[model samples]
Target: MRMLINVPETVVADGLRGLAAAHPDLTVDVENRVIVRRDAPVAGQVALVSGGGSGHEPLHGGFVGPGMLSAACPGEVFTSPVPDQMARAAAAVDSGAGVLFIVKNYTGDVLNFDMAAELAEDEGVQVAKVLVNDDVAVTDSLYTAGRRGTGATLFVEKIAGAAAAEGQPLERVESIGRQVNENSRSFGVALSACTTPAKGSPTFELPDGELELGIGIHGEPGRERRPMMTSGEIADFAVNAIVEDMPPRNPVLALVNGMGATPLLELYGFNAEVQRALRERGVAVARTLVGNYVTSLDMAGASVTLCQADEELLRLWDAPVKTPALRWGM
Candidate 1:
């Protein structure tokens, strides 16, 4: 596989170094592999910490800033970070209010964050966790026992982080996060597989004129492989899956996310079609975002995420946020 890296093992470390250099408002603990807002431990604010495997750029790491995650502990590419890393990050960011861990439903991530929470609680630091399992793509996967968390992971962080930044209690923040997860659903389709630097090969093989439906962020297999079809048809598949799960007759926040390699022009075209499909189904799209937010490394694909929104969710979502990837209303 063609990649720009000096060594496979150093890929994540090097990328973290680059991220730290690029964003002055963020600080990186290279040794511990933690990314945190430069001015952490905000007095009276509940700290939010969320992370998982690397390669999903602008996710856990790029999301560390004022109104989102206070700290993010990314593991190696497609590998879960250990408990020690999260424990240290929690200690560094926890204010008097406590810390909330917004974890995806992956098994490794769940277990490690659980240990970290216990460790922090032992030190008198209150800890709570909200697990995100919004992917309606599958009920079980190689990496998770239940539904895999996907695009809604971002929704939970943003909405819940806003509440925490507003100095909501830890329990309230956790509750909001859980609500976001409950209200959101996602489905992805992969046109091609991603190649990790270490593996130096595609994670999976997909021939021409075929697509994998309902894929995970780690290049894990989706529900099935099907013959390639028009963008409109693909958009319908995703929109239909989400609509059936949540029946979006109410206002909704929609996301059409590109898996690393999909171009923006294509994403916009797909986004338009997705919006059209939702409208056709009588679903109101109050807010729409299209971009490469959560990704698999070099995978050519896209995913659609829908989060049912009420006035409270809309308010929290509109709150100010200043992060490297998502910055608005600040």
Candidate 2:
């Protein structure tokens, strides 16, 4: 497997340096591994913070900007960031209002963020934490005790960020973030495995001509592997899995996300099938966003995240956001 990097050891730091140079509006601390909006410490606003592992690009880091995350802490590939990193981010971005931590439900992430919240409180910074556990796959997986967090992290951040940016109280922002998580469901399918920088070979052995349904971001074992299915068939399986477990509300915010190596052409085609499947289920989509938002490095696969959005959630979702990976109404 070929990867573009000088070495495996410095991939995270090197990426941070590049991200800093590319987005001057963000305050990237390569040494500390915290990415913050240049104009942080927004007065009277509840600061929004989120993070996870490194493989999911354009996530916690690329999302640091206006109307999104106030700060992000990036850990090594598929590894959770330490508590110190999150505490530093919380302390740096927290103003008089407070800070809200958007944490994915992975065990390491949950434990580290919990400790970080305590550290922030010790530093006299009030903190609220929202745990995103929106994967509709397994109740307990190798990565998490309950449902693993997946694509709903984006929905949680954007909707909650909008609320925070608009001067909503910390309590309100935290409430909305949790609400978004509760209303969203995701299911992923992998066509190929992703290779981390530390390991040149594929992390998991996924035989060719087979697909893993309900795959996790870190390439964890999904529910089952079956012979490859067409785009429409995959869409039906993914969507049916989601709705059968939790039927979404009337209008939804649809996110057809690529797992990294999948091209836009295929993603767009999959998006069509997803929409058709949703229509067949009698689900109305308020807005549809298609692309690689929450990725798992260069894995040839895709995840479908449906967020049941109410009027308020839709308004917040449509708000202006100027992030590196996701930008709209800016």
Candidate 3:
């Protein structure tokens, strides 16, 4: 594997150090492998915590800041964080209000976060969890029992984090997070596979002129492989899948997320086509984001996430957010 790194084992640690250096507002607990906002445990406010494997940068970590996550725990590439890391981060970031764990619907993530919640509660810290299962690709996968969480994870974090920052109680914040997940749906297509730093090889093989539809972020096999088609045709397929699953209820937030290697220009082109497709189905794109928010290492492709929005959800989404990956109106 031709990766720019001192060694495979220390990639996660080195990346953490780099993140800390880039963002002075963030603090890294190298020993426990948790990243926390410098001004954590904001008094009388519920704290938001989320984490997963390390490869999906600017994800659980980059989203940590005001109006987002208070703490993020990253595990090794495509691996779930241990309970000890989550417990320590929760304890450190928990104010008197409580802590809400935003967990993706993966087997390892679910199990680890559950254990950490128990550990935190045992130590007299109030904790709750909201599982994100917005991927509409499949009902079960190699890593999850139900729908796998994907781009909608970010929507939940931003909306729920805003509620928490507004000093909402733990139950209210958790309910908002859950509602976001319920109202969102996603579908992804992959033109190429990602190479993990440790393995130094593409996670999966895809021949030229072929595309993997409904792929997962961890490089898991998608629903099926089909011959490469026109962008318009592909966009129709992706948008239709999400619409069929949850049928856009008008005033929806549509996110066209590149899977790492796709260029920004191509993503914009895809976004335009996606908007056209959605309109054909009578869905209005109230707000749209086209970029690399959630990624799969260096994979080349994109995913579409649509969340049915109301006045409240749209207001929270537009609220000021200051984070490494996503920042605005701050």
Candidate 4:
């Protein structure tokens, strides 16, 4: 019930205004709410475009820069961007080398991005798409949409963007992106629900001592709910689920991501627990990251993602990246 700012009916527009003002170097299309590189359509290089809802800050938009996304469309909170917006972004970023759409495995996102790609192709722009479905918590492959794409998206954007920036062909970049998606897994737990500004209250109410397991990024109900436990116990359950689902012996690029409200101290503690769990299982932790990467508004929770790393993936991980959210190697 307590939040700042008037609830703008259109969350996407309000958020885009703030983001554009914050990063003048990134050009914003107010009509479409798409954030693109200040100088877009870089000649002779494949352009990378990704987008989703607005609440997950520093995601698609925060990732726009030299070595990441060329453009990102922003939707309303927990809502998919319309196809027209995506089509515009695609057209704006398209260069002679073609374009790539990095889509998360959500029903709306897939449908909208697919429509945009078709529209782009109709305009004679070459386009390739990669779908990321890396969450291990969901099952029923026949009926369900398989796993929900979660924290591994950050890795996908960074690595795939690097590939495009380095002038790799669209096919090669999309292929490598798929490889990254297949090798990654994520699981999340929620301690408290988030309030959508329009809704004016928390999406769900969790009693003081309960937690929801296997949560998705949109404050959706998780697989199970139970009394809250110690951070170590929570870490074991999450890390074990992911590790068991994937090959245990592979080196992993690990991420402990806070949903939003969780503090850095708690995230670090959870990361330590994750490291312990991985070590106990004899899994090699090649690199580690801890922060609020992908969030569900101000929800109190955390998700862990592990991407099996090889020499090629390691090389991509080491590639220089410059973005509002992640920057290294000037």
User: Which lDDT tens digits does candidate 3 get at residues 144-170?
Assistant: 999999999999999999999899999
Report lDDT (Cα) of residue 211, candidate 4: 97
Pairs with backbone N, CA or C atoms under 3 Å apart (clashes), candidate 1:
none
Worst 10 residues of 3 by lDDT: 241-250
lDDT of 2 by residue, 1-330 (tens): 689999999999999999999998999999999999999999989999898899999888988998999999999999999999999999999988999999999999999999999999999999999999888877888888999999999999999999999999999999999999999999999999999989888979889999999999998989999999999999999999999988767999999999999999999999999999999999999999999999999999999999999999999999999989988888
Better of 1 and 4 by lDDT: 1
- Tell me the tens digit of each residue's lDDT in model 1 across 1-330: 778898999999999999989999998988799999999989999999998999998899988888899999999999899998888889999987999998999999999999999999988889999999999899989899999988999999999999998999999999999999999999999999999998898988999899999999988999989999889999999998888888775899998999999999999999989989998999998899999999998999999999999999999999999999999988
Global Cα lDDT for candidate 3: 0.92
Tens-digit lDDT string for candidate 4 (1-330)? 777665658567777788888888799987768899988999988999999978898888999988889999988888888888888888888887888999988888899999999999999889899898888877523223767888989989988888888899999999989988888999999999998888888888889999999888877778889998899999999988897788675799998999999999999999999999989989999989899889998999899999988988888888887778888885
Q: Report the C-alpha displacement of residue 74, candidate 2, in angstroms.
A: 0.2
Return the TM-score for each candidate structure. Answer: 0.99, 0.99, 0.99, 0.97
lDDT of each: 0.93, 0.94, 0.92, 0.87
